[model samples]
Target chain A: MEEVVIQADKLTKKFGDFTAVDAITFQVRKGEIFGFLGANGAGKTTAMRMLCGLSVPTSGEAKVAGFDIYKETESIKKNIGYMSQKFSLYEDLTVVENIRFFGGIYGLTNEQIKNKTQQLIERLGLTSVQKQLVVDLPLGWKQKLSFSIAIIHQPKIVFLDEPTGGVDPLTRRQFWELIYEAAHNGITVFVTTHYMDEAEYCDRLSIMVDGRIKALDTPKNLKAEFEVESMDEVFYKLARQATRAE
Target chain B: MKAVIAENISKQYNGKPAVEKVSFEVDEGEIFGLIGPDGAGKTSIFRILTTLLLPDGGSAQVHHWDVVKDWRAIRNAVGYMPGKFSLYQDLTVEENLHFFATVFNTSIQENYHLIEEIYVQLEPFKNRRAGKLSGGMKQKLALCCALIHKPKVLFLDEPTTGVDPVSRREFWEMLKKLKQQNISIVVSTPYMDEASMCDRIASIQSGSILSIDTPQYLVKNYGNQLFKVKANDRYRLLEVLKSVPSTKSYAFGEYAHISVEKGHQMEASEIRQHLHQNGLTGVEIGDAEVTIEDCFINLLH
Candidate 1:
């Protein structure tokens, strides 16, 4: 059996009178591409923040990368990478400068940062514009570069929150190729997205609604369980069922 | 006569052509869509048509008034909802509506009939600040403001991109009702499924138009025999299907959709049998219909 890279039992989070994530339980296997799906304000961001150790859970037990999230948050931080929905990068910095800055923050040697930056720039076909400011780059290139910078530290798991929110379909397809490569290299990827079609690309996924996981399984299994022909229909069935249950 | 016209409209940013040599028209009372992703010139086109920005090379006319020569007349005769939430967040829901109407030298009461259906939803929250409303509600208020002026033509840029599915459906229903009022509507969206809701769409990519047609016509012209196949081990099944000499395959839904080469004479049963022969079990295969996303993917390839 594959080893579990992330494990949570009765994990919960709350802000004031509202519960953002409620007693969620699941396991993410090593090297798995796990999709985290939810509508706006459905607790996906909160759940991901807890997993990445950016926020402490209100109550529950969880482990990430073989370390307890509550007691070993610093370790968790060291071993995991995170990219938010906005592609948080310095827009005024050049492409190469952005990579160097991220690499520096991660405490890489100057030579190491330079070498990796070169390799990544070449791989992404951004060699020509490495010196150009990020704000001047197109949206697609910025997304790809942000993703590469996130994993530059060689973290065990990378948390991506809606990494391709506004990109074109063609660029999104290429972004998934990079993710597939990361997973193949034994890096676990936890990604959140609203796009149902992109959900089909994951090895497995969990759908959240109103601070709870409404469905969890492979895309194929979820579609079969819902008896829907596409993920969009599956999402609609689940979301409507969730609303009705409430 | 066309309700809207653009003659070689183009815009440049620091010597780079953001909108290059693009021109299109919208007939009166027609629903036209500008389909593309972020930075695909959809917003640029909308801004030029709405008279918010002057194009470098072309002239545009809305409701028989030149976009440049008669800017105020064009603004008064058309409604525009920009991609971003540009409403006054500090104002109450009712205040936003009244302010917009007042800007057009009209009152909310004067145009109550024009916005009755949409305004009714905001009635309960008339006292709430615009910032406090949810994304869907905020969208409705923006639509209400844009229509309060009673414009003959409407321009919406990516209005439903981030909205929830239910809200998106509601918004489109509102658009349909507005279209029935004989308002020529031009909207842009990144969602391909929404293309079917429009009378016609221009599929755009990298600042260029790929195709312009009705959603049904686009699918009808897809020209592929698509099949959905599944088995016990899906990953292995995908690999096996890809290796098939006469098959071009990709994962779609719970199955791998494969397009067989012509003259191969392979039936679904034969494909299933072949899967069984390859040490796979419980293989199921059947013909499948194409979708807008599929058409877009095919076009991209």
Candidate 2:
């Protein structure tokens, strides 16, 4: 049996009188590609924050990487990697410099950082542009590099927030290939994306609507349940039911 | 008559080409899309045609007015919602709309019909600050502000890039309604699926136009037999395609679409046999519909 890496029961967060995450309950196994999908203002960001130990849940219980949310938040942070489209690698740093910087931040030793920097640069095919500033690289290359750095410490899980937004179709698939490689190597991938086609790639995904988990299942199962031919149809059918203006 | 035209419009930044000899035309009252990924020069083309930036070479015209010589006229005739939400963030939604109307030497009531449908959605949040509104609401407010002047042509740069699927559908419906009122729209987006919503689309890449045609025409004329190949392991299936003697293969949703070589007599059974020998179980191969994304990737080659 696969090990459960993340378990949440009635996890809820509130801001004043408004509930951002309304008692979401789910379980994610190790080496699973778990998709956390929702619309804008659907509380995806807020829920992700709570799970990453950046924001405290207002109620309920949760454990990430076998660490309690409230008591072992620090340990949880160390056990997970995170990358968001809005924030990634430093723009002004060179390719090698950014990798070295992140490796050190993740508490890697001098030798580990050195070996990681070499392996990453070669793996990403950044050897030719290793000395170039990150800002000088193309958008696709920058995103791929940022993802590589996010898992530089080989965390058990990685959280990606719209990691492929605005990227070209071909390049986006290439990024997903990297994701598959990581999952195959026993890393859990929890990602949020607006792309409907990408939803089909996940082993199991949960769709959020108005701060609630409206549907949770594999893509094929969800489509069969919704009586739709494509994931896009399933998403439209679910998200259109949202009464919230956002 | 053409609503907008570009004759090899080019723009460069720091000796690097941002938009390279790009040329396209928008018919009056047509919804034309500049479909490409980020940094594909969509914004540069919009800026040039909207008279916000002068191209380094070639020329463009909006509503038959030269972009360079009649910059003021072009500005008055075009409504541009930049990729970034360029509004008075501190101002209330209502105030921003009124401000844009006054700047165009008109009143919101004069062009009320142009944005009535979209603004009605923003009515409840009219008093809310633009900065405090939600992402979808902010986009609506931006569209209302852009339409307050009743320009003949609208240039929306990546308006739906990060928008949700539902909101994206609504936004396109709004565009369809606006198009009916005789307003030409040139919208850019990174979503290949949205290509079908436009009357015509130009698949762009690295500052170059790959193809310009209606979505149907592009797909119908894709000129290759595409197959959706699926196996127990998706990534492994993708890797095995390298040995399948295909022209090109792309990962599309759940399946990897392989472009079967034209006139290649290899049957699907042979391909299945090869995969089964390669230890891929539960393999399925079927004819797949060609989408704009497939056309875009093929054009890239």
Candidate 3:
């Protein structure tokens, strides 16, 4: 049986009069690609921040990678790796330098960081331009490098927030391979994206509408339940039901 | 007459290529799309055609006005909504609309019919600060400002990039209504799925035109045995599919889209048996319809 990796019970967040995430509950299994989807300002971001332990929830019980969100935020932060729309790499630094910097921040010793950096440079075929500045690389290579650097320390779960936006097809294809590799290596992948086709890639998905989990199931089951041919149609049908105004 | 025409258009910045010898035509009163990912020169093409940027080489015409020589005429005859929200953030929504109308020497009431449907959604928030408006409202307001001048051609650059799905649909609906008024549309988007919504599209990559045809034609001519295959073990399935001779596959949503090469005749059941033989279980296979994304992915090769 697959172990439950992420469990949230009535996870809620409130900002004064606004309930951004209202009594939402869901569970993600180990090594599964769980997609969290919603329209902009539909509380998906708020919910993700809480799960990442970056924001305090107003009221709820949650555990990420077996760590409590409220009492063990530091552990949660340490156990999970994150990447988002705003890239976390330093553009001015070389590929090797960025890897070393991230490794150092993750508390790896000098020998461990050196070995990991060497392995990454070799594994991703970046040996030729490992010393080149990140900004000089093409967008696709830069994104691939960013994702590799994101999981360099091998966190229990990796969170990707719209990682493929604006990337070309070939690069997106390569990126997903890396995701599959990471998931295959026993890391849970929690992601959010606007691309409907991307939503279909997830093992299961939870569509949020007006701060609630309107639909949560595997892509196949969701399509079957919604009687839709594609994730785009399913999302359209659900997003149109939004009664919240931001 | 063609709404837009370009011949060997090229642009460069500081010794770097932005758009190469790219060319396409848009029919009058048609929804034409320039589809590509970010930095693929969609904006550069739009900027050059809109007379906002001077192309380093080649020539283009919009509404019979030379983009270079008849810059003023081109500007006067086109309504442009830049990818970014370029509006007065401090002013109320109504003030912004009024300002754009005055710049074109027109009044809101004069061209009221052109933007009435989109404007009604923004009416309640007319007094709100443009900067403070939600993304969907801000998008609608930008469209309103662009149409206030009643231009002959509308140029939109990635107008729906970050907007939510619901609002994106609404925006497209608005565009369809505007089309009824016989205004030519030249819009760009990073989303390949949106390509099908346009009457025609030009799939672009690496500063070059990959293909230009109606989405239907592009997919219809995909010319292959396309199948969407899913299994409990996706990683293994992908590995097996890649090793199969003459098989091309890419991850599409929840499943893998695979197509075989010519003369390599096969069926879905054959592919199904192949997967079963390879030890991947819970197999599901179906004939998948070709989509703009599949065509774009193929073009990228």
Write one digit per residue (lDDT tens) for candidate 2, span B168-210.
8889899999999999999988788787889999988889998
| Backbone atom clashes (below 3 Å) for every candidate | 0, 0, 3
Cα error, residue B214 of model 1, in Å, equals 1.5
Candidate 1: pairs in clash: none
Chain B alone, TM-score, model 1: 0.90
- Model 3 / residue B58 / CA error / Å: 0.8
lDDT string for model 1 (A163-207, tens) is 886666667767877887788788999998777777888889998
**Model 1, which residues run further than 4 Å from truth?**
A241-246, B109-128, B132-134, B224-251, B255-288
TM-score of 2: 0.97
Model 1 Cα lDDT, one tens digit per residue, B209-233: 7778888898887777778888876
Candidate 3 residue pairs in clash (backbone atoms < 3 Å) = A200-B253, A200-B254, A201-B253
DockQ for each model: 0.33, 0.77, 0.58
A best-first ranking of the candidates according to their TM-score comes to: 2, 3, 1
Instruction: Give me the candidate number with maximum TM-score.
Output: 2
